[model samples]
Target: MPVKATREQRVGWHAAHKAACGCRDIPASLRPDVIKLLRSRRKP
Candidate 1:
């Protein structure tokens, strides 16, 4: 067996990515549109 990272590491990466993308001021009103755009551009 080996030492391993838990879900927090993965979750943290996404949080960091969002921060880097400057989503800090995303308004509640635009969340749905943002989500839709992200969903439309789903990863491979």
Candidate 2:
């Protein structure tokens, strides 16, 4: 049987995705939009 990915592997994958997204620079004029969305969302 093929080996399955562990929980840590899954979490690390999502963490990498989030970090990649955070590195993207939001336009200064639109930063508030990003801030509002982040504030409204709960942590996973």
Candidate 3:
């Protein structure tokens, strides 16, 4: 059985994935989550 990923790990993985794939024009499936993560980061 596989363990689930933590929120931080998921965010880190998503960021890394975007970095490797280029962030300028992400696929629709990944776009929402990526934007949500970025928005979270920007919040003070």
Every model's TM-score: 0.41, 0.41, 0.44
Candidate 1 lDDT tens digits, 2-39: 24745444344444455469646544655555555556
lDDT of 3 by residue, 1-44 (tens): 11697655665567666666755565566667776777776647
lDDT of each: 0.51, 0.51, 0.63
* Runs in model 3 lying further than 4 Å from the true structure: 1-23
* Alpha-carbon shift of residue 17 in model 2 (angstroms): 8.4
Lowest lDDT block of 10, candidate 3: 1-10
Model 1 global lDDT (CA atoms, 0 to 1)? 0.51
lDDT of 2 by residue, 1-44 (tens): 11585644544444444446766555565455545555555487
How accurate locally is residue 42 in candidate 3, as Cα lDDT from 0 to 100?
Answer: 68
TM-score-sorted candidate list, best first: 3, 2, 1
Alpha-carbon RMSD of each model: 11.9, 10.8, 5.3
What lDDT is reached at residue 1 by model 2? 12
Model 2 lowest lDDT segment of ten:
10-19
- Native RMSD of candidate 2 (Å): 10.8
Tell me the lDDT of candidate 2.
0.51
